[model samples]
Target chain A: MNEYYNSAYKPLLAIDCVIFGYEQGELKVLLTRRKQDPYKGAWGLATGFLHFGESLHYAAERVLKKQTGLDRIYMDQLSTFGEVDRDPEARVISLVYYALIKVESQTLETLEKNQAQWFSITALPKLMFDHETMIQMSWGKLRRKSRYQPIGFELLPEKFTLPELQSLYEAIHQKQFDKRNFRKKILATGLLKKLDEKQKGVSKKGAYYYVFEEGKYDELISQGFNFELKSMAFGS
Target chain B: MNEYYNSAYKPLLAIDCVIFGYEQGELKVLLTRRKQDPYKGAWGLATGFLHFGESLHYAAERVLKKQTGLDRIYMDQLSTFGEVDRDPEARVISLVYYALIKVESQTLETLEKNQAQWFSITALPKLMFDHETMIQMSWGKLRRKSRYQPIGFELLPEKFTLPELQSLYEAIHQKQFDKRNFRKKILATGLLKKLDEKQKGVSKKGAYYYVFEEGKYDELISQGFNFELKSMAFGS
Candidate 1:
């Protein structure tokens, strides 16, 4: 083993999170104002350097918790960004992670203190560095992953109505869907269990709530199932 | 600008290319023996440090060209691997890019000089660091991406038969697809233009050769047409 080659070619590693949440009828991303320079005060994705004695997931989770005070949130690795001067200050490489969390979760207050804000996808501000591009890529990823995977459920409350579910898909998809067709396709998948309860907040004809039937979806997916919603019939 | 908060941190960034090709009815990944140490002689993904002023895509192309003497390949960013000690030699953050190329296009002489070899996914040897895991992840990515994207075409010859196309999918999917439905769904996408010519190498009942309708696919994709291969009639 050449010790010189081992020691000489050290590369820096960091992780950045593209935290997403749905609230107020729009798709929004969680971002923070950088408190440091080179790009100090510029709004960027919630990110940090990887620490010793931790896995990449743990490090990302730590950054999420520290920045948002949210624990056990839905997070997944997105990609790694490593252009040599992507950081300008150095050869910093970022392992980007994407997260979808309930908007009403308790983490909002902590994020507020840290200058974290949620910007609607259609109305995003100019972000620092390549963060805007990161968000855009994350959106494309979310749209793709949400279809085959049961991740759309992550954007909704544990108990949600059919209309709410459709809207969640609409927001993520950025297109309208026919209610009946959407319901038919979703129910046909056998991945949503209709609860005996109704949503009390909005109606005389109250909408029934449902929870994800994860087991059935998993079984079907193992048998090679694809969840597709892109169609003229669904009002795309 | 609070320089104090950011002045101390500088990091290194590296790029790892997950170059994949199809040959002998199997999907293979390009692996190189680490010439320099830390893990000298250990097998790893064909990777290199990102140089200044080059884009990520350029870096990926450079890595591929250096190893295979191949250019203009179908490549995209897969994900970043940023475990703190993912590189035991350094805090290197690796942005993993995946490339799909025709197995026959890359000459063996170039790879021999570069000490790189293509290994079947199923028969891979022990790799350094997280490369084995990276390769597995890239395989999953290929499976997923190939299902909805026109990427499998990258692994096929410029012109190929329906059987050849199906074989490529099966190699990546590792499953038997119903031939009738597979052909129907793929042809229906309008991304494969049937040539008048037939491949007469195997049988008298020659199969028609088809070329990837790249121009049409690109135009349609821009106009929001999706390419997917899931079918209800596929296995039923």
Candidate 2:
């Protein structure tokens, strides 16, 4: 550390990650049981201290990767929560981040093997030291972001039916929307390209699949579109 | 600070504030000239170091209060920037915040006494390390937020005409809009309540004044109205 760095008394910096995944018509967060004292054995967000010569983004990504056993997750800085005495043992100011990952069967196995388990956002276990608040806020961000812009698409397979897309939105907003209005509102966005292919296994007369059009989304964004989902029947 | 707080090799925490004010139909940011070096005399955002036991919010407020001499302002966290060696002197991570303030003449004088001046976002002077990037990102946040919600209204007086309101929007988006369509779109939100009063000094036929209805705004928000200023007209 430089002399200037060492001159002042500093606060211990840390990162806490809230990993969200959409699975089986639900939004879930990954929690790992704390192995040590203070909040020993309690469910909590995957945590790591910022190491020397590491950027905050790198530290956060490293933490998420370690816990999820997967690389290149869609992670972002949700916000920083520095409540002075947030950490009981230390005066730590944490840069809290949230990651959205797709939970396929293979990835789910990878997570379980790494000692992390997915808990539904609504039915979370007792969390340690403000971790619950962190998770709640992360869910709030996801909900708000999904409303204003398109997300949760990453959790979907490349081709998914309108029903699957609606289920993802319902899981995020925690509300059952009217099927007719949901379909109308989503189609109005012009960002979802309808595919000719249909689901094979579920039924004889299968529903058509759709894929999110990234180029069209970007084009609409440049025109000041917020991906705003408005006037839709949220729950019927 | 507690003993546990002092138990680690911690990094110094700091905050930089980007104070935005709208004047003469242009968006401006408050800048102060540095009295000391590495970038001595360069223009920079109002900044302060986070002290022990002080939350990041409090530290940011103190910094803004010092610069603008305003007791209350609409301030929110923009994001955290920590690229290990960002500061040449130390490993410092800054929590940057942006604030929106009404620039009335009374408050403007207080800012001058504090040796801070407002610069148009488009014509900013060379800034200190990473301050420019911080300002740009803050602007991006503000633009996105204003598009999704009604924010520039804080920069307006208690009452104003549609032209005045439109001017504020233009300043924020940095683009002119078609007046007829802008009026039609704004009135449709029902967020604005028109007053019978009109400006006496401006012209013989003055425009009708209007005020934002907070109660209606809140009601609409609860109904999932995003305060979204969607497409009406961008440049004429």
Candidate 3:
């Protein structure tokens, strides 16, 4: 709306979100069918053009809400993609962001109305434009961040069993962790609070649910402690 | 320039480089004095507008070469700054990049010709626009990245003493590390090639000079090894 610079070249600005969600012990990404030409009906990351006078993060949040009908999810800027001809119809420079959402938060009816679906990272469909590249980069960010930060918790429910937490890590990293070793390393951080309540129907001996203690995690980080679970024994 | 999308709004695109260099046991950043009216004479990161059809990395490289007269340096995209009022003269979106260069590689004559100077991170001048925020963000990124990657080598000479390497890490992280512990952890990685030569200037007992084994570092990284130096004791 503001023509602040009349003579400078302006490239079209846009934002694309790689929204990750975990369900049934698998990591999945939310995608929407393109409604316009240039790739009509093709699946792609949830994306939208940036509105004038809006911050980049706000644009990403708006796009995520528009596509998934969910708000207040954990989101991070992955990187910016400006490959000149990345868009077939225009020279649109896009800022790619990754979001982690709880799968149960979105209703099936909303997803149907928006023509949105979740695809496992390993089995993604042919995406329009350079979206496949964006998804791959987002997956790398998630895997790297999950090792040092409790970012995987965003994909799981607030209260989760140790097994569920380990499953989420395995899904992101694409490698199974030794069950006993995983629990030991994670619990040793003293960042998880074990709830007296137990998860039902997951196992015959229901595993006790746990919640991440964000305050304690931050405090530990301030005191020169890093959260690293990468050394846990890897399973074949 | 190709006018592919005449109807869409195009924000001005630009790239800014936070070029970091190390010299005499201190870390410094390359800065230029603005020549135009918006922030004339103010110190800021070297930056330039993106040319039509130029990729983001190319534009950043061009800017780096132009300001510091250095090419093919180790650079990475720090982040994009798209705040609506980030630039007072125009609605410009900046893709900020951080570059690590060996200080001795640049000539003083070239720096004088470009009116660029290196400033210590601890004592930076008043920068124009939101360049200060960009520098702060870049420092955080450098610190975080230095912990998990062997990026500190980018700021050091090809053959460096163990104390020089430790000093570079100390400057970036703003903390002191235990001498014995730091040397043990770094040596155990086997990514440093201990040279047969010794450096005699700074200490009564000359220290051994070493060079980073980049090939081995990459090989180890490909095999799922992380380069971590955070475990060394930190000082108050």
Candidate 4:
């Protein structure tokens, strides 16, 4: 590496994972206590220094799995933060990615309690460094992705109700939506197949259950059909 | 600076700028020759190594100035590329930014041929090392940003004809639009102040010149109007 390049200036690059999980009908983000010199004992996004031989995607996945004991989750690169002093110790450039996980089934209860926990985004504590700005950016990306892609399915179980999907969108968007228009737009996408089931625990109405039709969504996308769910117009 | 932190694995970060300029009624991107080893003869995005203690924004702005000989242009961070072998010479991560420069004036002719040249996007050569992908991504961002913001004015002169503005849109979107509808939508925005002067070179009708009202556009955004130039229908 030295023979091929200049060795004078080298900045440390790290990868941070903003894992968003929907559990018990609320949107939550995973955080952990930093046990090092900078921001010691303060809650921050789960992060790790990148290994030399691995790719960014692999590093992000490794951090997610090591922290939560989960694998094969959906993650997307969000943005890179390179403020000179974002890290108090060094010029560390952090590439942030967001992960969507269904927390009800993948919860690691035995993970280091002093180091890790899921916090409701609405009631999050004051974070260290620029972690709060990263979360806000990830939240905005998630909201935009939810409307443009069938990502709401990533936050729910294998089977879910229309109301569950609507509620998830509302939570991510932080607004109310008209139920009829919401259902109309979502079902019109033709990407959800009604399952012969009902979510029995919550409602007497037993809202109809549905599963995301992966094949149909891909096929429709290939044919140029857009998946859009318009939020209820604000202050209308 | 190296008391507690290990400095063994730091990699040099570089900034590659995708400078966009509109000229000859087409969208253009600035490219440079790789002056050093790696791909010495191949054309690539204008780039330079990040200097110590300089923020990414400052490095990007500096590179833009070095290549274009222009200042205070429309610049934005697109994304960062960090594949281990992306540089071929070292583990170099490139922070890419997209910019808009006024090209119709003599400013573009003064560009140093040794460092940069503006190429029409459609006739661009095979770029070096994931640069083609970077250009495509930046182009997509440019299109989306144009629709949601008033940045499209950056590409036009201080005063331009309606046909010129339409041509700029067509060049970016790569599609033909209904002239009447385009005129109606733009005039409805009330953000274009018509000038008493007319462009005499084009037609007998002598298209009127217009100036973009940045203040009016900003006020309208605060009043809840979105800047949308794309067709609402599938094939309209």
Candidate 5:
């Protein structure tokens, strides 16, 4: 590494995971007590230093799994926090990634191992360093991602009704989307396949179930497609 | 700094700027030959290493000023590129920023320094070490920003006709937008202040001149407002 580069300062790179979990109909963020000396015992986003030759995705995934015993989470790079004093201890630059995970009872024991607990985003405890700003920005990023991406698909059934899908979005975004425009904007993306059977259950007129096609969705994103849901826009 | 951190590996941090300049009615990207070896003389986005006490914004601004002799440019963080082998010579993470600069005749000498040249984005020369991907992603980010922000204000006068503004958008986006929809959508944001007088002497009936109020625009963005322009539909 010394022979290859000529930079005077090598900042320690760390990956901080803002793990958002949908549990019991609430949006929660996972945090733990930092075991390091600078802000020891203070709550901070679950973070891990990156090793040489490690990809950022792998580093973030490794941290999420080690902290919560979860895998295969949906992750997106929110932003990089590189203020010189963001970390009081060292010149550390954090590459923050927001991950969407569904919390379940089964992982309670594993989460407790590292003193990691899920707290409602609305009522989070005091955080360490710039963790608070990172979390705040993650919310905006999450909202933006929800516009075109299937944000809650991991927590939804493979085949779900439009109403059920809208409910998940409303929970994550904390707003109600108009039923008519929500359906129209989502269908406009052409990523959902209309199933032949209608949803069975609570009412005489059951809404039809739709399956979100991942392959088509990926193509849309690749082409820089923008999907706009007019009524009850995100944060409206 | 050692008292603050306990990481074994310190990743060198660098800032690569995808400087987007609108010149001669075309979107151009600024690139220069890599001053350092392994890929010396290969075209790459203008880059600079971060100093220990410098903020990321300052570092990026400094690089931009040094490369093009321009200041007061609008900048945004696009993303961080940190693959294991993104830089063959070393393990370095590049915090990429995209800047919008209006190219003019007066700064030609400064741009010629260090062999920096403005290449049309569509006909970019082969770039070195993931710089091409950095530019590609900047386009998406810029497009999204243009939907809500004043993307071409620096190039236009404080008071300009709707046609002048629309022509700038079509040039930057490389496509045409519907006249009626563009006017309606822009006016809907309320960021544009309608001036009392219309354009003079061009024709029997001249278009009204609207002033884009930056103070109002900033307020709207602070509230996490998502502005949508329905007509022309951006990339549609």
Candidate 6:
């Protein structure tokens, strides 16, 4: 029995995360430089081998916390990468996860110590192995999800100006939307609460700050109200 | 080195398929009864252990073929289920996949020999080992994907009527769409070819037959056309 069990084929299970954060009208992905061999010193998605008796989600969260020093981040399993040669070291099946992290909420010291850095999605560095493909797939999923879900809220501060929200959407979809149309459609959803205070700086006429009303959003979702934004062309 | 490798912890990897088919105005999922000791004689998703050095997608396809005698089906990796106690027998991590197959295209002999059967999505049996959760998650993903992609076409016959297409959508979303609006919206996309044929069996006044034009759909998709049907309420 021991010999039979030992002879059975076993492949290493792993997890990789595409950590996305939005800031300054740009979409960024957090990446870490490989500190070990095979692709040492090369940038890649934060990844680790899944341990025994652990759930995939738990393993993903562990990797996220260990790499970014962020806990309770919003993450979803993007897809599994099981190409024959995805990892050169051994037969490794990677369950890739995409995480949305508020850029301001992360600790900079942890990133600096681990040689972790955020790069613009448009100008990503050469990633080791199939990490680049994972990032591209995550970006595609994010763009599609953002159209129907208010996932952009995960990447923003607790309270943000209307322009900041709009910029985040524009950065995500990689296109400009009509201001009036965008505001009218988004406001109709009733998922944002206009705060009493106005955001100072960045404009002579400060824009009003708005907070995402999770309770209202959940209520609307329960009632089957879908969130959709028209895919307006550039300069629309 | 061999002793060390053999002594290391290893978890069993498995693949489960949510095989979806549309027939008789209903969405159906293919299931099989477990023949082995664990959950013996209980209905569950068609599943198999993943072999060493095999890709996850390949494992899913192999399971589909072994259980249904189907090949080259439209399948997508839904997500990985890796809860520690998901499988009571062992530490099993299941990679779940959803497959779309035309009911008529399948070989029924293999299904009968394997004791595999199709159950309506609305009325499923007590599935074994977290299989119910897998089916529900796959259904959710299918409904969402069908909204923006012509995925339901995979479940229908090559030549179908307008009403048939409408029924497929209704069955998937579990709601009725406005006939006029659904037809108008679907036709405007130019993804269906109206054939000179008519389907007379379903109604006295036969509906005109239409075929999904895959090439046209692909072209439209490349040109940034999104497939969407308004989620009309029931009895609309």
Docking class of 1: acceptable
Writing each residue's lDDT as its tens digit, candidate 5 over B67-180 gives 877787888898998898988777888999998776662266766666888898889999899999999999877776676566667655568888878877777677898888
Q: Chain B, TM-score, each prediction?
A: 0.93, 0.91, 0.95, 0.91, 0.83, 0.92
Model 4, position A190, has a per-residue lDDT of 86
Model 4: per-residue lDDT, tens digit, B1-236?
45445743576788888988888778998788888787887999888888888888888889888887777878988887878888777888888899988775334346556566779999899899999989999998888677657788998889999889888988887777778778887787788999999998689989999999998888888886767554422224
Highest DockQ, which number? 5
Where does the lowest 10-residue lDDT sum fall in candidate 4 chain A?
A227-236
lDDT of 1 by residue, B1-236 (tens): 13542443444556788889998689998888988778789998888876656666788899888877887878888777666667776666667888888778767776788888889989998999888888898898888777668888888889999998888888898878888888888888988889999898698899999999889988998887767665522342
Clashing pairs in 2: none
B203 in model 2: Cα distance from truth in Å? 2.7
lDDT of 6 by residue, B1-236 (tens): 23323344567778899999999999999989997757789999998878877888888999999887878989999999999998777777888999999887656776789898889999999999999999999999998888778898999998888888889988998988889988887887678999997777778889998988999888878987777654432233
Q: Write the residue-wise lDDT of candidate 5 on A140-219 in tens digits.
A: 77766676566767666578888888877777788887888777777877878999999878569998988988888788
Model 4 off-target regions past 4 Å?
A1-4, A108-114, A231-236, B1-4, B105-109, B222-225, B232-234
The segments of candidate 6 whose C-alpha lies over 4 angstroms from its true place after superposition are A1-8, A231-236, B1-9, B231-236
Misplaced by over 4 Å in model 2 are A1-7, A105-109, A184-197, A213-226, A233-236, B1-9, B105-109, B219-224, B233-236
Please say which candidate is ahead in TM-score: 1 or 4: 4
lDDT of 2 by residue, A1-236 (tens): 54434655578888999988888898988888886667767889999778878899999989987887668878889888889878788778888999888776336567667667888988999888889999999988888788768877877878899999999999998888889888988898888999889988877899899999989988988887767564452343
Q: What lDDT tens digits, residue by residue, belong to model 6 across residues A72-103?
A: 98999999888878877767788999999988
Model 6: what TM-score? 0.94
* Consecutive 10-residue window with the lowest summed lDDT within model 6 chain B: B1-10
lDDT of 4 at A227: 73
Runs in model 5 lying further than 4 Å from the true structure: A1-4, A157-164, A178-211, A219-225, A234-236, B1-4, B154-161, B193-211, B222-225, B234-236
Superposed Cα deviation of residue B182, candidate 2 (Å): 2.5
Top-down TM-score ranking? 3, 6, 4, 2, 1, 5
- DockQ, candidate 2, comes to 0.48
**Highest lDDT scorer:** 3
Taken over the whole model, the C-alpha lDDT of each candidate is 0.79, 0.83, 0.86, 0.81, 0.80, 0.85
The global Cα lDDT (0 to 1) of model 6 is 0.85
Give the docking tier of candidate 5.
Answer: medium
